[model samples]
Target: MNRPTTLALTFLTLTLAACGRPASTPAVSTDDTSSGSVADAGGHGAGGNGAAGHGDHALAAPGPDRSRLPSRAVLGPATVAPGLRVQTLPANVQPNLLALKVLILSSGPSDYGIGTARALLDQSGIPYDVLDASRTPLDTAALIAPDGSGRYQGVILTDSALIMDAGNGTYPSALDSAEWDTLFEYERTFRVRQLALYGAPGSVPEDYGLRYVAGAETATTSLRLNAAGQAVFSDLKGAAIPVTYSYTYPSALQSVPGVSTQVLATDPSGRVLAATSTSADGRERLILTSAQNPYLTHSQLLGRGLAQWLTRGVHLGEHRRFLQVDIDDVFLEGDHLTSALTLTAPFRLSGSDLLNVRTQQDRLRSNYPAAPNFRYALMFNGGGANTAVPTLCTNSPWLTRDLLSSVARCLNTQFDWVNHTLDHQRMDVMPLSTATTQIQQNLSVGTKLGLNMSRASLVTGEHSGLGFMDPTDDGTRNDDGTAGPKQDLGLGRSNPNLLSAAVSSGVTYLASDHSVASQWDAQCPTCGVPHPLNPGVFLVPRWPNSVAYHVTTPDEATAFYNSLYGPGGLFPYWDRNLTYAEFLDRESDQALTHILNGTPFPHFMHQPNLRQYAGGKSLATDWVQAALVKYSTYSKLPLNTLRWDDLGAQVRRHTAEVKASAAGTLSGTWNRSAGTVRLTSSAGTVPVTLSGASSGTLYGTDRAARYDLSGSLDVPVTPR
Candidate 1:
C-alpha cells in the first residue's frame, strides 16, 4: 500500500494469491484533480476553492496535488524466500562510542521524504549520511565501526516498509528479510531510536500498532497534539498544526501484545496521524502516516521535533529565529512624496519622529512576548549630522537640527549604530585616499556625536565597492533601481582600493546586497563570504524589502509599489494593484520565511521610513509590527536580535563549522550515562550546539558554545 501510484495500480490489476480478493478495480486512483496552493499564508490557498488571491480578485485554479499516497488494499507480511536467515544479536556486546550523527535510509534519490528530512538537518547544521537502499547494501559493517563503536546515534527511514515495485505487478520490500533483521538487531543492541517519515499500516518488516482507516486526505486538516506529542515536540506551543495538501492516512492504533503505542497527533475525526510504538525488545519507533516535502508548512513545523526525538535531544546544530532591521541613511534627509503623490523636498527625522520610533519599539517589545528584544540597527552617514547641538531635553517643535541631534545624543545607546561612510558617497570607483577618508571621517563624527558605534562593521553607500555591477560605470548611474543592463564581474574584480581602505580602517564585516546573487556565500547559506581580493574583510549580505526607501506614508508607498509591480508595470508580478495592507501581508510573509529559516541577515531600509506619517504610524514600524504579529501566530520562541558585531562573529563561526563538516574533521560523542558530550575537531574552531546543555550562550531553549577543537573537549548535558 505504501508503493507508488503506478505500482499500486499495477498490483491491483492482478489477483492476490494469499487473499482471494477480486482484481476488478484499482486500489488507488491516479486522477490528479486535487485543489491545493502553496502560499506564504499558512502554506495554503486563501480562497475557498484552494485558489490564491490578492485583495478581492481571485487567482487562477490551482494545479494538481503533488503529494503521494498509499494504496487502499490491506497489505500482508513480507515473504522471506528459502535460505534467508535473521541474524541474532551477540549477548553482552557493548559499543564504546556512538557518533553524534544521523543515518537516513531511503528508497532512492527520488523519495520526497528525503528532502523534508534533509532540509531540517541542513538548516540546523546537523551532520547526516544518506544511504540509498535501492543502490547500496545495508549490513552490520555499515552500522558498526571496526572499533565496535556504533556509527549513528539515530536512524531515519524515508518510509516505514521501504516497499517498492519489483517489476511485473509485484511490490516488495527493498531491504529484504535479512537486511531488515540486520537493521533491527543493531537498533536493539545499541538502544537507538528509529523514525519513519511516512508510513502505511500493516506488517511488512514490522507493525507499528497502526490500522489504516482512510487515505488520500488532500484538504487542509488541523491536527492536535496529545500529551505524548507535547513531550516530544516541546518547542511547538501552538494548539493546532495545519496539514495542507498532503496525502495523509488517518489510522487507529490497534492493541498488540508486548507493544505499547502512544498517539502523538490526531485529526478532527480522532484518528491518529502520528504515533510512537515501543516494542517488547526495547526498540522504539515513531511513524507519521502523512506524506511530506520540504516546501510544505507541516513538514517545516514538525521536522525539528522528529530530529530532536530521534537524537534524544542531543545533536550538533541549533535553530533560533532572528529579526534585525537596519535603517540606512540615518541622520540624513531622504527624498519623500507630497500629499499630491509628487516628489517633494527631502526630509530628516524630527524629535517627534525619533520619539515615535522609540515608542513603537517599546510597544512591540511589550506587546509580543516572542520579540521582547527587538531593536533597530542604524546605519548612519555621520556627515549629515550636526555635532554642535548639545544633548538636552527639548520641547516639541524645537529647532530641526537641535531636535534631531540632541535627541539622538540623549538616546545614543538605544539602537545599534554602524558606519555607512562619511558623506554617503559611492565607493565603487572612488580613489584610495577618498575611500580611506570616508571610512575614517565617519568614525570621527560618530564619536563626536556621542554614539556608541562599532569600528569593525561598515556598510558602504548603496552597497558600493562590492563589484556587483559594471565596474566601469560612474557612481551617477542608478542601475539596480532601474531595469538597466549591468554586468557583475564577480568578487575577484572588486575594487582593491576599497578593500584595502576597509582593511586599513579596521573594517572586518563589510555589508553587501543580498539581491546580488554573487555577493552572498555559496557554501554557507547564512554565513558571510570572505573577500577574494582581501582576506581580512568578509562580506555580510543584507536583505532588502519591498518598501521604497523614500516613501513615508502608506498611500505614497503603495503608489510607488504598484507603479513597479502592478499590471503592465516595469516588473509586474501580481495581476492587479494592491493596497498597502495587502502589500504588507505579502512582504511580511517573505520575512517570516527568512526568520524561520534562521537567517541572521539584517533587513535594510532608509531614514524617511521612520517619519510619523499618521497618528502613531510610520512605514518602518508598520512593517515590523506586521511581521511580529505573523510570527506570534506560529511560535513562542524568543526572537534573537543580535548586534552587528555579534552577528558577524556568528557568521564567521558558522562558516568555520561548515568547512570543518565538509572536511569530516569534526566529531562528537554523547555519553548517555554520564550525560555529557565530547566534541573534537582536527582543524580550526567550530561551533557545538547541544539541546538541554549548559555552559553556552542561551538562545531560545538551546545552548550553543564555540570550541577551538584542536583538542578534545567535553561539555555537560542535561539530555532533555
Candidate 2:
C-alpha cells in the first residue's frame, strides 16, 4: 500500500468572515463537568447546538422529503492481492434523511484518515458518507448547496486540499481570495458541526476559532486532561493519557469575541493538545492532536468520544453502556474425587459438585435481585471419547453416565448454552465435512446426555486459534510425510467456505477478538466497518481479558489468577498478589474499569472452575461469586445477566439497528410529556435501549409506548 504524503493536511484556507476582531485569552476551566453543560444544550427545548429546530421534543425532523437515496454500490470480489485486503462495504441502505448524517472528506485510499473514526461510528451504529477527494476534489458549491440546500449536518476533514485542491503548485492567497469563501459562509449561516485534524491556519473559517500550530520538534509528550476533556472522555475524567508526539501538530484555539471556547487537554508545557469551540450560531468544532496514527486503543477511545461529542451523543440511542458475561468449556469432564488425603478414580461430576456450583450461583443471586442472578452463558463441548461410550469413574454414589445425566439435569433451566465443537477440535483447520462432524457430533452427544444444546452459536475450539482452514498444498510432502506450503487464512480477508459452512449448519454467532485482525475484518471489535458476512450470523469478539486459568491445586489456581495481575496481568496497575481476600479487591478493581466505561462485560471461564479444589472445596464457585459481586457493584446501571445466546441475539439485532441507522432507515422522537422515547424504522425490528428504562420492547416503524423507568422493563425488543 502507498503511504500517505503527510500525517494530516496543514490547512485549507476558508473565508467565512475576514480575520475576526482579536478576543481576550479565554479563562480555561479545569473542571470536567464543563462538557456536560455543553451536552445539556441538546436537552429538551434547545436548538442552538442541537439539530436545527429540534428542541426538547425527540422528533427533530428536518423539513425535507423522506425518500431514500440510492444505495451505495456493492464492491467487486477480492481483487486486491493477499494481505491488506479491504472488504467492500455493503451498499448503503436508503434511510430517512431526517436522521443526522456525517460526511468524511479524504484524499483517497492511501489517506490514513477516518479508519478510527469509522470504527467508532460503526460501533455506535451511526451512518456516515465518504467523499474521496483524490478521485474528485470536493465540490465546494454542492457541499454548501447540494440539491440547492445544506445536505449534511456534520463534516470531518482529514486533508487540507479538500477545500481547494489547486493542481498547480500555486497557493491560494488570503481567505477572501480563495474559492472556499462560500463554504465558510454556509458553515456560519447554517451551523454545521465539524471535527478537523491537522489543518493549517485559515484552512477553516477564522470565526470558527481553532488553528493548528505545529509544535517544536520534541519527544513524546504526556497529555493532561482539562475540565472540558474530562467531561468528554470518561476514561480521562481523573487520569492523564499520553500520546507520543514528535513531528505532530498541536492545536491553539482562542475564543472569538462572540464564540465560546474550551481547552480540553494540555501538554506539560500547557500547549493545547485538544480543544473544543462552539460558535455563536451553535456550530461546534473539536480539534485534537495530530500524530502518527489513531488505531491504538487510546486513540480509538479519543476518536470515539469525539464522534459522540460531535453528534451530541444521540445518533445511535441514548448514551447508555452495557455488560455481558460468558463462560466457555462447559462439559462433563473427568475429575478426581479426593478424601482423607487420598485421591480416587476419575469421575464425570458428583452430585455434591453440582450442589456446590448451584450454591455459588445462589451467592451470585444474593448480590443482585432474583432474576438477574440466573445462569450466564455456557459454551459446551461434548467429550468425544465419552459420547459413544460413557467413561467409568467414581464420585461416591455417582459414576460415568449417571453422574453426567445428574449434572445435566441440575443445569436444565433458563440458560444460554453454545456449541464448543466435539472433543474441542479446531473447526478452522478442518474442511467443511470435518467441521460438520465436529459440530454435529457434539450436539448429538449433548442430546444423548440430556444437556441443553438448542442454541447453535458456535464459539469454535480455541476460537479458531488453529488457523482458519487447511493450507492448499503444492502436492509436496515433508520428510515426515507432512504436507508442505501451509497457508494461514486471515479473518479480515475473504473466507467464503467458512462462512458458507457456518450458515449451512444454522450457526448464528461466531467468535472474533479485539486485536489487529479485527481492525479490518468483516466481524471485528475494532474493525473500521464491522459487518456480518452471513445475513443472520454475527461475529462477536470475546471481551479482551476473558481468561482461562488452568490449575489442579488451590495454591496453583491462586498463583495462576494472581499472575494475571501486575506486569503482564490484565491490569498491571494492580500490584496486589492473590490472597483469598486480596484477590477479590484486585479482581474487583480490574472488573470495575470495564463496568465504569459501560463496556460489555463477558467474563469467560472454563468448566473446571465448578469442580472441587483441595479438601473438596469448590474454588470455581468462590471465584465466580467474587467476580459477580465486583461486576454487579461497579456496573453502574441495573444488572441484566443474559445467557450468551440471548446476549448474542440482542447484539445481532442491535447491529442491524446500527447498520440501518447509518443507512438512514431509523428515526425516533423523544416525547418528554409522556416520559417515553419512540422510534420508527423501515425494517420490521429495531433493537433499542431507552435511557433509564431497565426494560421495554420497541419494534418496527410505528410501534409506540411510554418508556417506563419505574421498573426494570427496558429489555431490547427481540425480533419475532
**lDDT of the candidates, in the order given:** 0.69, 0.43
Candidate 2 residue-wise lDDT, 1-720, digit = tens: 110011000110011011111111111112111110110111111111111110000111111110110011011111111222222211331111222456676545434444544544554445667776446533444453323334454667653333322334332221222323444444555455677653332333344455545433233566677777867764333445545421234556655677777888877778776777776666678765543233222343365466656654434343223445455555534223232212234333344565555555665667654224556566666762244334332243334445544455446563466777665544333466656776777777667655665464777654553232235422121101112211234554434445566667777766643221331233323222233454555676554321222233455444544443335543232445556566544444344433333334354545545566544355555545555565443222344555666666655555555555555556443222343334566555555433223243222111112321221222222110
Q: Name the 10 consecutive residues with the lowest summed lDDT in model 1.
A: 1-10
Model 2 TM = 0.55
lDDT of 1 by residue, 1-720 (tens): 010001121221121111111111111123223212222221221111221211001111112223322222222233433226666544434554678888988766444456656666766777889888878878877888766778888898877876554434555666877888889889988888999887766665788888867553434577788888977876676478777666677889887778888999999888888999997687999998876655455676677677778887777777777899988878777657553446677677777788778888888899999888888998888877778987854544455456777777877888888998887765666679988998999899899989888779999876777775444566543222212223446787677889999899999998876655567764455567888789999888776676766678898878866755578544455778888889888777667766766768887877888889887888998999898887777676788998898888787777767667757888788776677788888776666555556776776555666666666888887655
Q: Candidate 1 regions off by >4 Å? A: 1-93, 161-174, 200-202, 335-347, 392-397, 400-402, 471-483, 560-579, 684-687, 694-706
Error of 1 at 78 (Å): 11
Evaluate residue 693 in candidate 1 and report its C-alpha lDDT on the 0 to 100 scale. Answer: 66
Index of the highest-TM-score prediction: 1
Q: Residue 650, candidate 1: how far off, in angstroms?
A: 1.6
TM-score between model 1 and native: 0.82
Per-model TM-score, in order, reads 0.82, 0.55
